[model samples]
Target: MSTDTEALARSATKFAVPESLWNDDVAADLSPPELLLYRSNLLGSDLTVTNFGGGNTSAKLEGVDPLTGETVDVLWVKGSGGDIGSMKIEGFATLYQSRLLELEKHYSGPDDDDKMVGYLPHCTYNLNTRAASIDTPLHSLLPFAHIDHVHPDAIIALAASSEGEAATQEIWNGKIGWLPWKRPGFTLGVMIRDYVKQNPDVQGVMLAGHGIICWADTAKDCYEHTIQLIADAASYLNEKLGDAPAFGGEIVAPNPERRAIAAALMPKLRALMTGDRPKLAHYSDDAETLEFVGSADFERLARLGTSCPDHFLRTKIAPLTLDPERLNDQAYLQSSLEDYRAGYAGYYQRCAGPNDPAMRDANPVVVLVPGVGRITFAANKATARIAGEFYGNAINVMRGAEAIGAYVALDEQEAFNIEYWALEEAKLQRMPKPKPLVGKIAVVTGGAGGIGAATAARLMREGACVMLLDRDEAALDAAAAGFQSEFGKDVIRTAICDVTDEAAVAAAFKSCAVEFGGCDIFVANAGIASSAPFEETTSAMWKKNFDVLAEGYFLTARSAFTLMKQQGEGSMVFIGSKNGVAAANGAAAYASAKAAANHLARCLALEGAAHGIRVNTVNPDAVIKGSRIWDGDWRKERASAHGIDTGKELEEHYRLRSMLKRDVLPADVAEAVYFFASDMSAKSTGNMLNVDAGNAQAFTR
Candidate 1:
């Protein structure tokens, strides 16, 4: 592999799909459905074989019908909207083979093919609720016992080439048949079934502008054959490719400062793209992405769009490419966005029928910036990341097709038809409704602490992506790892940031912008505590308290406010203490510093109001359990102030001191923080909410 970007583009290496990973020992004890799942995972694991959620696999098995005590053939296929790689047995839809064959009798012809889908439910086997994919007939109508339908980039390249049919015959020596382009449906499935009957020796058939389908008499053979077919296609393409440069050779080198540039550009792009709803962003500047975007043929190829239905469904018809030389030109960027929207709307108007689903948001999902990289936006982090992966697959397809012959995209009419298909529309409608904070991004200072971690978790549960910032690197890693396991890696990121350092605070916010587009909620919860009489307070104690609570709040808020102003709307929550308002008897240094922090929120709220940014404070008192602050000297100091033991006695003292006589936990403060961070407090700003168990002196004036 070459290290130079241009040299890497010019170097053509052999593309070898991994060999079949099946083991006889593993398959010996497995049931028919379990074997099918094992086979599906092996194929779907490699992107060269199939992109995420882009393929279907099935096995025909004998089972006793639940309603009737008779043996019947059941078609267990990958269900709708399921990813073959990670899916379990439950992800497969079970339908009676005889009933699926009977569905063909009611099918009038090609025009009435869609009506066939409506009858699929009547064929349910074992009363399985999993919805059958539209590709069900492609498996059931075939004569083979097992089938694999996958959109491998290698095979799709030949399928999408202008000379695809002739190349398919030359490469496979007539063993793999070819068919012209047709939208996937019952009609296409019937065509495939008839073609295989005519060519009895064929191993598989490549569908033009789509993918390949191969089958065998048993599960293992079918899985191996699928891998072999892809490997062969890749082998042929590599020989034909020679040392030819991909994508017409790189036009420019990858920029070293691209990440910084992307960070600067994302917030603006996010603001532009979020007309309907907010979108989280994923950025990729990998070797492949940088090579394609910097190539001379980038614009021409990107404009032609992705050929596979699975590709376009996730990435949209075409990506919006920005001029590398004018990337910093704001007017040019805005104009380009407007032009792309206009083109999309025009395409919709030209191809849509009366019954088609109303046009979706016209914003582009994938954005290609030359010399920088690819940035994809979606309703959440996972979808955004997957969109980028799918586009990368499309790039590979384009490279292979162009190497063999001229690359071709799906026709605009056909693309639009599939894009607005009624079944696809129904699938969209079936998706769960968006959560309250679906596309929102949050940053929490002191994120390794109890209250900070609790606040981050609460925000994530409501659908927000979060960046955890703490000065303690080990603690930050542990906290981030826990959240990543629970919420997924894409939604959580960590930064070793001391909020008191102005430069680190700014850089952390910049990283948040680059990682998740921008911040919408900023939780300034980082703090320190000190307890001393007014006369006994040391200079270092007062300054240290002021530095973290007062100065740290000021720095993080300033950075967050800048980002929110760019985003046009945001929320900021400051975690203060009840002592800030009530004034503690022995904790003069901590109490006075908190008072300054509370006043800072009011000032920021006034400043941010006109820009649609809301600032509020959550004042918590005596939250000892699970609190890192209370784990150290602060606990002993507060205990001494109250003349109580430094253990359970201190907790009981605080509980009884409150009017309600209840213990305050980190979760309680977190809820109050969430209220201010969410739209529930949308109209309320410049206000302080006390989370203490009701102290008379702590009552707001």
Candidate 2:
């Protein structure tokens, strides 16, 4: 900011500073190096400024070598594999400028460029090693004390165009160096050095098909200059393009409708993307996505390449664009995705060196459907969401380039080198192995609380995309929120479903299918408990228990069977009751209903065996503490009917009946459910697992 408060207020720069930060005396007290970290965070927090760890920042500081005991001017540059947006003091890897320049001689030009990235850790300011940004040399060669290099969308629009040179001079009112596209290495670093030598008065340099670099002695000056450069480019583009059209032609359906479409298409899409195997699908149709898909040049612009190289690694170079008319054509959709996969393999082959690892999976990260917007696929919800965010900003960047001039992207070879770079590939190898159920989809009925909620959480912990269904709208919502809070968003989908209603059951399954493709594991857990002697049972009371406990299981299992039959594989677990086996007195309605449900599971198992679907049952006894079925006076009712005095005594009666004599918590039932839901019981079906602390009565032969 200028020293004059009046001029600062009236500055009219398109890149305006937050008014609250303008006169902060505290910021003034921060050292120049500390301000570099501060300003990098501020610039990075905005996706338009830097997309997904795509930028670097630096500051020059004097440091005494601990071992050599000599005062050396060190260039503290943002390290490799760190995000500038959330970087801290340690994020800047300190390098001795004198030692760094020594490696510039062995360059032998671009062929040996890989050495530039490999040699950085050995050129540190002290004994501790850190992988510095390959661009560290450029920062040390520049005379400025503070420097920032970012892939801002506005500037990249100009930098990536054929007209980058003329536009840079026209917009900034100062000549900017323009180097032809060169992969980050010794050659590019040297080119930057020679540009400074020639253009002694220039404030910055722009790399064609790459991005821009700016510097000044102060953090405020450098950051302000970076912002102004971006602002000016944006102004030039806006003036040339006039007003941009708001993204349109989207359906903007209600949640259920959108979810239904998602469920219907997701299965076909997942099958196409991964063949017979399973994967996670994340759907969206936000305004930016709507506009991008609806645009006339959507296909041409999308094929141009990632908005930047970093985006390519996360989003792939180009998304798979599918026509909504082909939604029902499973063969065609799968064929289209397969063709995209093959094309990516061909691209990798054209640029691969012998040292490069086999081309990574052929699946495209982003898939676009007109009117439906976009869907990102990943092993888990978290990575899919990350790619979704990157691709979202990418549409804006590509559009800006169209408005500015022609949007040019890195060539296939340029992007291939970065994608296959050993350093880059190593990052993925370092990630921990995924959970066993990482890509599996699970649906848990009655998921609001009790055993259902515990099973939902456990499935998510093992990395499944879980859908929660219940009759209580408020409880279902609260349960969904808790899962999302614990697992991060998009991992859980909730539906207000009364399992007794076939239409609602079908819709809930349809929504789950759309949200996460289709179900791999189904838990028919929704039930109601109403007990009375067979002779005393009223028609109303008998009908209610049977309707919820038996009919609900039948409806859910049918949906699960249909989905599995179509896909040729699935798992189902019916939550049964011990009363069904022991036939407790005065529990005729509850026991009989549960008995029918258990038998229903066995019948379904016989038919599903042909389609590779496994079905089992979990008989849980006297889960009295957390059972909502015993919420009101039902606990007392059950106790009195059984000749027991209190709820505590009633629970103890069932506990003592078990061989292990332990309290059977809801989580205990969830564990038995997980065994069948996962591959652990791959060959087991038509079986009943007693989760009542070893109740012999409920045990199956």
Candidate 3:
């Protein structure tokens, strides 16, 4: 190695991208398409290499034509909106190489390049339904059999540096070439093809203000080259980096109580962001994030905006930075958010063409606070988390670029064009309509129980992110795991919380705020059943019932109310027992406790009405199936009271005793809870719904 290379190797330790993970054994038996997917996954596994859905990979391979039964060259590229890390083979769009090449005849110039996307459908090789990405032409027009186009933070740092071309020439000498920025489309693809033709000896080219495109004859060679290039850039940046602190040193020290501050601020921030529609949030206060937010150049660098298209697409043109000292000042925070929205509106108005899509919600997706860190809001938890990740990548790019030279951002007009492109608008339109509760956050007490789990499922089905709270850790994990598997891990979180403990209750709700921004629905479904004749009832039994049924309800509801009030709207659903109204013969303690809980809901509803908080109840009778309360002593006691057998006979006796002769289930109660939880009962509050198989005695008077 040269003296400079040896010195770089000695000095560079920070920000190293992991070596290539490709294994010969893993790739040996895979087909060409599968190998392409494997290559994409290996490169995309690390955020330092590429972000979620931010890069594309393509393979030119021989495929049998269905009609002709002859082998033909085909191009398989990452489909539109597909994440390379997690995408399957089916996520790749297939097109005929010859047809893609023929598209050159239709392209008039850069002005008509966007029209080229319309012609891609005619090039589909096997009638593949996966939509081809705009980057398709960039890959197809290249001569290599395998290509990887990725936005690695390390390489992007060089691309985004003001001295990027000089640095590229310095680092690689003539092995790598450089091209000026051009939005990814037919025109840019032609530019890349021409550049490669002129510099056939060069392995790749860094696209200024964007990323890098590298290719090789084999997928393994391409993967290795990509990793080596990124590693070299990271080392070069690290070596060039002096002893100075990043972002011009820290302007504010990270507060140890930053999470507490974030929890308090999130609901208010969410309230402001929800003017157009509800939004879920993700908070990050990691060391790296804190460093960036607390840095002196935070505002300046953020104002310059992210250089990569993927970064700004998720994070927006820029983030809104708040004064850390004014975080607790509600009016100040509100004014700051309003000012941000106004700026965003002005940005849209200035850049929008006559044919551009109408301006979207002006609320900022990312918020930066000096001491606290970064918070991102989006339509759901995953998107919010991904946005935070993308911004994190942008931060790294900025750090590296500043180390090498002055960081630069894409031009304002170019950024606007990409942000509001007609094709991008069409992609947005193609997304499935969001569910009714798309941005709502919910918390279910006794979340491991049948009723709680069912209610959580119901709310989640409508697009609400749920936090499951239960005292039983094992059951909570099992329940959360099931939901995570079905609904994805992003939408579900678990907390070990006993509802009766005020501290635990408060902590659980705080956790909900930190995990999902704020709670919009609180399902008070935690309960325990007790039975005793009036003469046999003890003070201990009565106190136990009240402590759980009535007091537990109070603590959780109070916490929920506090959070919801900050957000300006919420719904609370209390799961009461049918006996609370009908008065069971041998269950005085359970019955009276539940009655108190029911009455409490009415009082809260009356008080919360002016604040847009809706409180309601769903009373379920003899929910024998899938009910934890029905599994033990309560079942035996109720059966003995009716002189029936302990198992199926008791269930049948209650079913027959009901006016409708139907057995109630947890799912039945959940449906009632759902109605109250959603906007379906928006106009009806301070009310109760009976899921009791029509027992007139339990009906609300």
Candidate 4:
């Protein structure tokens, strides 16, 4: 061989070793300039595997935010969408480690972005653009000091092949882990989290049909390993297929008409995922305009996955194809839908075995048809993007596979196995975001008092942007203040609303949607209580308590329910009293009102189920904080009237009667309220959870 040819052969052989096996120490001490060089070389190989803005990179450092009291902090996560190969300090967002961890613990409602809160606690981003990369949670999920997420085409090409996973595994040699596709964002991050927990030593993860993730002790190590990882995969591919083939087929052109088609389907698709119309990002007018105005294959092109995995979690496995041939008639569309449903059922039955689990629903994430474009589905804008990514990638892989050896996806049975796998499905149900209610708008009736305040605070913590509705504006403001002090002003809202008035209730519901997008969770927590003999409860006396507790709960819950039903999915909680089940002597009016409210909750649950909404009731025993009936003098007078010691009367009224023998505090009721309002109880509907410290059994006059 010529001397230069001999040198080239040696260099190529040196690059053949698996990169992940390298010790951290080798790249650990590299200077910044050296680190940049390593990053460039690594990315050159991986970049072909990633699409525009498909990945992010970060390096960890211990520091303090000088402007924020010099608190010890985990500063600077790279900005969303910035290329890691040439990332700069400015690309990173500064996050307070303590705050991010704290936010993760905050409970969120089913309707909110728990992931965003989790990300927020760890990263700070540009307030100017108001967008963060969807992969931020992956950064939070990693324990390593550095993190990198990329859609390496070679890695994905290897992973997307019919035997892609097996092929990658041969190269990965158990050092890396694999996550089945899900649309990106919280769901994908969660999938990564579970995998990492099981395989703490995994240096990288392959997102099938999506991308790759690589991390280590430092930036240079992470970047270099990524290079090595991709090179190894490429080598494997080269050995199997010889030289890679050139792009042979006609690329699909973009058509502007595709946007109108996508826009039409988005509304229907969003409701199916979330049971509500979640706030979504605008569709890409640029891409749609280009696609719509350009190509005949635009529909086929839009049917694929995004450049990443979690996009499937958000968008589903594929888009529903809008075939022009089929679209010509309603019957044709109906027939196609029937086939889809049957296919889904068949797929489900084939997958579910004696040991297999069940999911909330078995539905196709996407549908494909010839001629027309695809419609991506999601619960929100973020989810839609994720769904789109998954579909986009799937189309790419399927087409490519056809050229090699006919595109074939995991069979119905195998797909079913994955779709219903316990761990995978559980990602949808894991340690929920504390603020599941964050992006969602909500209203809490009786939000001025203890139960109301506690429930509202709990919802805020979980992520609902709230409108505190009550007649007592000052008290509502005070209650909201306590929550705002802890959570921040953006979370709590207050409005002077008397639940007794239909017009006022209607207005409040309207206000909630207008202020914070739309209402998704409602807490009918406001009420009044008083005791009077059934016969002596005059019309005026009867009307007053009943108006607020019974009629009020009904009115607010009804309006919220109507709005929620229209939105497609929602959750509502009615705060009932233990008196509803075990009546108190001389408390006929209060008990009757609570009983009615409980009934209403059951009815709401049954009706809302069709819309994918959930409704439940929380019944707590008497709480003493700021109760109108429990003023000191009144308590003493009541005890004397009842011929019982005040302490005995109070004790006998609550704690000692229950199995747990503890007072049911406002916070305790709030816990149950939060449970019913969030996804924790996605399958628990129309049920009542008692927060009486086991007081349901003990009752007396």
Worst 10 residues of 3 by lDDT: 4-13
CA lDDT of each prediction against the hidden true structure: 0.91, 0.78, 0.90, 0.60
Model 2 C-alpha lDDT per residue in residues 1-701, reported as the tens digit of each score: 22322221221112212211223465678876677788887778876677767789998888899987889888889987888888888888998877777877767877776767777777788764556887787787667788888887677767776676778888767756677777676777788889888888888898776788888877777777777777777777666555334222122222224445666777767755654357777788775676577556777778777846767788888999987667787788878888998899889889998989887878988988765767888877667777888787677667566665677788888788888888677777988888888888899999986999999988888988899999999988888888888997778998899988999999988978767778889999997877666798899988888898899988888887877776668899999988877677787888999999999999999999998999999999878777777775667768778788665788889789789999999989999999999999999999988877886666676
- Which 10 consecutive residues of model 4 have the lowest summed lDDT? 8-17
Q: Say which prediction, candidate 2 or candidate 4, comes out ahead on TM-score.
A: 2
Give the count of colliding residue pairs in each prediction: 0, 4, 0, 62
lDDT of 3 by residue, 185-235 (tens): 999999999999998899998999889999999989999999999988887
lDDT of 1 by residue, 79-121 (tens): 9999999899899999999999988889889888789889989
**Candidate 3 wrongly placed segments (more than 4 Å):** 1-13
TM-score of each: 0.98, 0.87, 0.97, 0.43
Off by over 4 Å in 4: 1-277, 280-438, 626-641, 644-653, 696-701
Which residues of candidate 1, in runs, are more than 4 Å off?
A: 1-3, 12-16
Tell me which residue pairs clash in candidate 1.
Answer: none
The superposed Cα distance between candidate 2 and the true structure at residue 603, in angstroms, equals 2.8
